[model samples]
Target: MRTADTEPEPASDHDGQHFVVRLLDAWYVACQSRQLRQRPISRRIFNTPIVLFRGSDGRPAALLDRCAHRNAPLSLGTCQDGALECPYHGWLFGTDGGCQGIPALCGSQPGRGHRVPRFETQEQQGFVWVYARADVEPKTTPFVFPHVDEPAYATVRYQATSPGTLHANLENILDVPHTAYLHRGLFRGVERNKVTATVRRFAKHAEAEFVGEPVPKGLLGRILAPRGGTVVHFDRFVLPSIAQVDYALGENHVIATTALTPTRDDEVVLNSVITFKTVMPRILIQPLLVPIGKRVLAQDRAMLKAQLQRIQDFGKEQFVSTEVDLLGPHIWRLLRQAARNVPEPQETTPDLPAVFENTVELMA
Candidate 1:
């Protein structure tokens, strides 16, 4: 229950610099655990190239993609015996990025000054996370989905790349009204119901609760809730870049939590975990769940690509907002302040009038 007040401040700028580095000191989803293989895999995060490989004991390891000797890509090299051998000069490097052997010289020095930069990496919740700054430890734990480990809940994992900024896609997932149009038939029914949502912001997180939403008439509705009843939905955002949605119908609840990380200046990698509790065995249900989840994400991916294209063509964003834009503005402000290493203004007044219940009407 740590509020923004207790959260550590973002990394401070050095040498009189004003802006704090955005990804430094944060843990970002580098790739799914399954994506790593016996061969080294190259991944780029925060616009920096990194290579991931498995050690001799099969533990995950990561390092800067470049070899210190010739600046060749270490990812093209071979991995064996918990060490990576550079393809160019047959220089073998251990899991710690230390030079271990040199094929060319029998008595070559294997120690000092011949090493590549290494990064801190951890595998959790089916994803491998890379800490952006080698000097800073992650302050937050990687997100985990509820019921993922429970025997009664069926879980489906998915990954997608969006041609949009981290801010853009984060806002898209929490946006409720967009589903009726952008994801029609797939997520929402043709019928438009006036839904009300109450939004509140805390120190490090924010949430929107939707009330008066009728049972959806789409395919998802039939799968999640056949007998129509009032649906309780919550859209939430956590610090850094985590967005999740929960749909509750009586005792059964379906949840999808997505962790987004910036792979480039204009692109983000999405790692999603979808889980639900049901009477049926998960083995029978997972096959049906995967396809539907993929379809919904496909629609979102397409829409975000189009939006990014529009921004590129116009050279800037032309946008307007109403009170219903409950979370977008807040998210933008948080990013802006974090970039400058400034404290959140609302952190001091947790019970401010604006932080309390307020509702917005939208068609769902």
Candidate 2:
């Protein structure tokens, strides 16, 4: 099998165009690992149709969904002998996307070599990621959910699709003040709090930390912070659309990371994994945790949908960022740099601030 470095000639799709070529080169989560079984499942990322399936050896394979001959969707066909069979003409395509057998031709070779685009796919951290570029490898491995595999931590995973830009979702996850108002009774703080936050930015990453915040009074606090103390909250934005938020309540900590992948310009697939190290046993508290987490996610989804609709109608974004919107600017800086395959200079407007602190006042 050829490595991702050896790309086939670009697919005839619009993605081959120069304008979007760079964006397509980056790796994006195509679907959850559990979703692809022996039978094929079709999904589209960056507007490229892909059919994902597991070969007889149990490794995942991704192929352009269109059949080489009739352009029939290979996903509608069946998997046999470790290859996908085109239902329309009974043509079999091997894992490498090369046409192998044609029923009509019987032992005779089908003239004119043909193959569909096969994308580079890797499965890690419970998700399947694909590089849309016909012949490029991802610069790094998929984002790691370190706690998920750790024996000491218990993790709960949640997924949803939001009708918003990936940047919008990233901003929402890292925004702290919204928790009080948007998640009033669930994860918000009750009293007006004066919080001190520091935002630090580096070459390809950024983070914000909030200090002197009171223990959350919402359901999350009830379960994870039964014995209250100061809560130290931190938010970070990793390159290529990943947000990590951690809340430390004394010795117990609640950490969640959300990885966002753009399915389209206005739609993003979000995978959120929340892990906790608490006094209570994980198996005992897992059930309660999922519902509360879901409640919070639902609220975020509603707000994002409303925000997307407004942007769609207005045809532009003109929102203002304040001192509290510390993560937003840095997120854009790194993401835009990565998209352009450019490295952010050590000094520039919105340059990585080694460390910067501010005070934000909010009425919960």
Candidate 3:
């Protein structure tokens, strides 16, 4: 029943020594809205355990998974009349993490001092988002997926978890060169046509626009762009963790946006929304696109797993970037600066020339 203006104050004793404190200030999707019913579910984000459930009011709530009474996981307990009951000792807790009743007290009210830490929750774009930092109010809202619910577009949504760090997963999502080799016949072939990429970097964002690119000579291209008049491509990254790729061919357009959430240092969950506006009908396009999308995601997942394993074996990341490695370096720098709570120096002003703009030629 708490409105945005009357939100609860943050807990004072919550853990604040996370590896990336600034990253914790942002919102991350905990689960799809349809996934959370009355049953409690557990998720680990930023290496912190959390439990999510819906109250009797049909609103979602998030709290630390542990119970204050005996340190038992609350996710294992059951829901009763909008409150969570601890299975070990039957301690009833409300959405606000307040102790509602103690079974042993025989209808006596529980002490106000007994409570669990709670995180702010918001439902947007059919997903449940949780603010990671329980000790501070959220600075911003969740990132919105583009072109959602538009009448002209047909949308497909799915999630995949990769055995790689959050940065690695995000970098892979926006990297275009890997698609030619890794996806091979499924997505693109090794035609190696010279392409020009114009890259730009901002305070909390970065993007690359590709030109002079040849039409993809793959099964996907054949199906999506049969005529293939002209192709326009762009890859963009937003701070915290979001990557988007857009493709426009003639009158058809496709946009793929991914939001990355870290479950641990070496694990990440990707929630992706693929939207396209084409001449094809929704009924036919959705059925064909879903399987093809799954196949492409499976390939990326496997490669990411292999990359993580090699990095683990080598003890660290050894990466070399060339001119065509457009967005990887920029993404890393932005994340590093945000982790340290340092602002990127602004080099461009009204009187000065553009700060970072370059064109690189590469074969794809």
Candidate 4:
């Protein structure tokens, strides 16, 4: 097997075309994690096997899982001297993935040719991200929640290994109109309030701000929103990943935040942390709201899990989209462009690809 350095990296563009290549560059994905078990945790990207290990520094690191000696799984071995000692013959490898110790031969080294591949690792925000592409510097900061990370904040994590394409789920979460039907009791009210809204697009961003609300009804409107007054719902979708809808509940009062992450193509981990920036005592708010916030997530899971199964059976070719599914189409186009070997133009460059209209306009 080729060493990490020897392996040729996938270039952003074989031609001069620039597309957003997400997988190649190293990205700081998490900020917090308790140690996992001593055993290796298996992960696959599109189906390639990898093993995650905690080095002697008590930090998380990953390897190709295959040992260099005879391709024995290094994870099958035990951790000694801060490295994995091969169970088969006691060949130990360092965090850099080079064979460091050969037990039976005390004075002899395994030599320079013996090494395993190392993957770039960072633990932030409570998760892990592996860079599968090559020749790119990391452009993203560690995953963070500025408000939640502060003192006097209480947060909870919900991790579920969901099934189905992440693209479908991202669009579903961002599609506000569907809640009137798909999530009748949870997200939106059963009654349809007629409000006309316009969608304006500019350079990879779009927003639908709701106005003239004869007012929305149901649980959120009742308990969370201002009583007998107009409330504005501004749903914003930040580039690459992140969607947040802030319902104006008076000055500086925001109702919710939902972060949907693609753990894999067929699975996603949706972590919803709902907090109010109030000086209220923890005893008062913790008991009153934590259960309700978790219940909101449970409501989504019941519906989405069923939808996922149905889609997997039908496969990708049969799914249909209406005018509301525009955002999803753009997401797919971008992902495909990345897979087809396109490089991304820097934020400073405004050059347009011939396949796209202008960098500023949405291709209609």
Number of the top lDDT candidate = 3
**Tens digit of lDDT per residue, candidate 4, span 149-204?**
65545554444444545555555666666667655554457566655444433344
Which predicted model would earn the best TM-score? 3
Candidate 2 Cα outliers beyond 4 Å, as residue runs: 1-22, 106-112, 347-364
lDDT (C-alpha, whole model) for all candidates: 0.76, 0.76, 0.81, 0.54
Model 1 lowest lDDT segment of ten:
12-21
**Candidate 1 lDDT:** 0.76
Q: Compared with the true structure, what per-residue lDDT tens digits does model 2 show for residues 302-338?
A: 9988987776676556555556666776676566666
Residue-level lDDT of model 3, residues 252-360, one tens digit each, is: 8899998888998778888999999987666867787778878888998899888877876766566656777778777776777677677757744445543467778
Write one digit per residue (lDDT tens) for candidate 1, span 250-278. 65678999888888767888888888875
Q: What lDDT does candidate 3 reach at residue 281?
A: 69
**Judged by TM-score relative to the true structure, which candidate is superior, 1 or 2?**
1
Query: What's the residue-level lDDT of 172 in candidate 2?
Result: 89
Give the poorly placed runs of model 3, Cα more than 4 Å off.
1-22, 347-355
